[model samples]
Target: MADDSDLEKTEPASGRRLEQAREEGQVPQSRELATFILLIVGVTALYVLGRWGGHRLMHMLRTGLSFERAQAFDATGMIIALYDVAMEGLMTVAPLLIALVMATLVAPFVMGGWVFSTNILRFDLSRLNPMQGLGRMFSTHGLAELVKASLKAAVVGGVGTWVVWRERDHLFGLMLQPLEASMDEFASLVLFATLLIISSLALLAAIDVPYQLWEYHRKLRMSKEELRQESKEQEGDPQIKARIRAAQREMSRKRMMAQVPKADVVVTNPTHYAVALKYDPEKSGAPVVVAKGMDIMAQSIRELAKEHGVPILEAPPLARALYANCELDQQIPAALYTVVAEVMAWVFQLNHWIAEGGLPPEQPGSLAVPPGLDPAAGDPEAAR
Candidate 1:
């Protein structure tokens, strides 16, 4: 069952999955590439500092070996002489050490870039399980690593043998030459051998880099089921999202209905549509639709308005227009401004009459709502 599941992971890993893997400290790495870089830098540092280093080393050796008879007799003098020799050796090698250190720091970025993660630091008991350890040792990745190691050993060994064979004449001749001449020849031979080794490692690194990347991505591939699960995690479950949307809509409707009591007038289709409008001349230039709804919600608006003594005006065309075109708490369309002004005028007069105990003001007649603003006017089925 596990083998079948593994076989089913044919899709490439998504960016989110890759990022999550990186967070867990799982990233492609080629040991050969890092080793190759360090060697290359070390050799370059040696080549550049060789002549100066040789002179310093020779001076240190001569000074240490030819210490005065007086200094050799005194323990303090002997200690100072030893310290000077050690300092000279450290200075001579310092540049090459620094280069290798820098190369070590840079090598990981050659493939995976810098990743600072502490997840891998956490201890796991599974790592200590003998069965799991044996399984990992016999895994396909482990087999590939074994093959690469074998190839590298063969290449390095072959290069060393070839260099020895090629320099055999020089090696034999160095014994007969003057000490100074022999030292130069020895340095040349060492440089040549180092270059040959670097070349071999470069070839191994070039091959290993691509293979490591391929293997890393292969390990992260997603099964169809896994992809679906991941997408759900990222996007949220569809049914839950729909329920959230329904909840948000209900909350918004309740908020709109709360504004009905504050409105100056409720324009209605009497059965189908209702829009509660509010006008504040000092605050706004035109009436704003504070609440609007259809059917059951419209009935709720009417009941709330009646309870608060807000005027209910029957104007089907204006109600439909406001419901379709105007959003809550926004000014009614500019084309309906003249008609809305008339309704607002009626509202003020009706309030005045109710307070003064006089005859009630006449309701607005023939609200001149534009045909384009009325959605029902344009729909043949509604018109019928």
Candidate 2:
């Protein structure tokens, strides 16, 4: 019972599942629909061509039966008559044959579009396994097929018997009537039976179409675990992806540290943030940020600056603003021109005083950093 439940297809198929099934050439097709179409086409073709065919058939019979004096003893004459009879028979049924062939060719495409695959034609050795074949024959699907076939056979037989009983008088009188009249009545009876059978088949086809579609979808249903596995396969494992991201950040941090010693000065938020800037009048008009970091990385940048003898200035607002707005290797914003120029002048003056071995000009007392440029709001020193 547990095995049976496990085999049951409960969940709807995903788009990938449906596509895979279609590639394998497993698609919904109603055999009853094809049968109905072929029957209707055959009956209709006969109805349209019956009169013309009857005339030709009669002419052939007459020629084949007629005796000529010149051909009375000629064996070649008999051969000629036979050839004429064969040609007339071929012409007589040509339209019906063509109609049946066309119906057979077209019926499947109307259900599942045009899908031709060599996969289905390939022979598998497993198909010859006696136990498996027997199991399949007695399977639920196989039993359902057997039931459907039986019902169809019964319906067709019943209709045929009823039609024949109603036309019994015509059949019995065929021998008494002229050949042409008998043939006409026989044709009419056969056409009537065909129409009845086709109508019944159409009804069966209507029921079978939806059933086949349902069965097709059921066969393709996937379990929850299967869906999860497929999704993981497509997107990759999340843990591995997170590790990759961490490794990338580590490499970027190392590169940022490498550029810190090259910067002319380091701006800091005391202990939290650090931004390194480099200025060269010959190369660029404005100072460019060479590196920036927060917390642990900020500490590393400050240590590298001190070790390399680079100046470190405590400017919380400038440090935070540069870290927030400027990427490494990018120029600072134009709005910070005045404040940054003030800081640079102070650094240059201090450098000149130390180089000349004497007191130099007094540096600017305070920089006028922009109001909203501060990352930390309500800092009086940043705004001033």
Candidate 3:
């Protein structure tokens, strides 16, 4: 049995899926993972550099503050102050935030490439009905949204638990340390924790990017109905193509019939084959095959020849040879020149004897050649 999903064709998401995901809160989670990774790497590098610089400065400040001289205490005052410490912290951390913002801006391209289709933005008036919209809101996609939310919660909870467990000892140790020392240690620990979290989120994003791309391509696959529609748009209807072919054949038949009147003689396989030949003394020494056909086209050619009063001779071998070897408006082969010349000579003699009021000469044998004609002289057309 076919599954229900298989029975109904799956339509593409048409950009709407991304928009829907945004409305359902998935977009932020997706971006968060990418941003988190960038933030972690940036902060980690900055923290190490800042700590090294701050440590040296703090040591100098302490040594200077230890002196009883008024000038030394004044010189060290700003470096050891809480406000200055806070400002330094901001300077060190700002790059991490900037990196996170940059990653967020680039995340969509890394994950989905540059698809700028506006298909999802169009709204149907019918869908504006409150009841229909509400129904769709609570549909199968709504269930998917719930599942995604649950998965996100689980991931965050699991990671949070692990972080807490790993940092428990250091966190507890912070309470026993002096105020300034504890603050310094707390800042470093917080930066490290942030880095670890960002790394985990980035890894998750890397896996998801490929999955999203594959899913997008799968959604774009054409359904059977869509393929059918596209084919119709490209090729038109089969019935129309057949009608056009029929019209073209009719036009060709008329043109071939028109050429038959100009032909000198018609050769036929009695009923099945017909070929019309034409010869011009100045233009062609050998006869040219004007038209030839078999079956219905043959019948049409014979009808046209009778209408034009052209002589039709029953010659099976000649008709078959002309039909098989000759194309319209092409001169006959040199090998058949003797046989064709004899036939044409007979035709001319019959016409001449009829005009002069005498009986025509008898039909000649295939081996007979006219006087003054050389069998090996080659066709006059070939000489030209």
Please give, for residues 299-334, the per-residue lDDT of candidate 3 as tens digits. Answer: 888988999878787776667667766788888877
On the 0 to 100 scale, the lDDT of residue 123 in model 3 is: 68
Compute each candidate's TM-score over C-alphas: 0.87, 0.80, 0.59
- Maximum-lDDT candidate: 1
lDDT of 2 by residue, 1-384 (tens): 735755754678888888888887888898899888888898888779878988788888888788788787888877887887898889889988999999999888988755777888999999999998998899877887888799799988998999889888879999999989888988888888878888888888999899888888887788787877777788777888899899999998888788887788888886888899999989889999988888888888899999998878887777778888888888899989888887787778777777886876564555556777776768655433
The lDDT for every candidate, in the order shown, is 0.89, 0.83, 0.67
**Cα lDDT tens digits for candidate 1, 1-384:** 768877999999999999999999898999999989998898889889877877787788788899677877899889988998999999899999999999999989989987888888888999999999998899998998899889888887888799889889979999999766787888888888888888888888999999999999999999998999999999999999999999999999888888999999999988889899999889988899999888898899999999999999999888888898998889988999898889989999999998897888898888868768888885554432
User: Which is the winner by TM-score between candidate 2 and candidate 3?
Assistant: 2
Candidate 2 lDDT for residue 283: 86
Model 2 TM-score, 2 decimals: 0.80
Alpha carbon deviation, residue 233, candidate 2 (Å): 1.3
Candidate 3 clashing pairs, residues 3+ apart or interchain: none
| Predicted structure with the largest TM-score when compared to the true one | 1
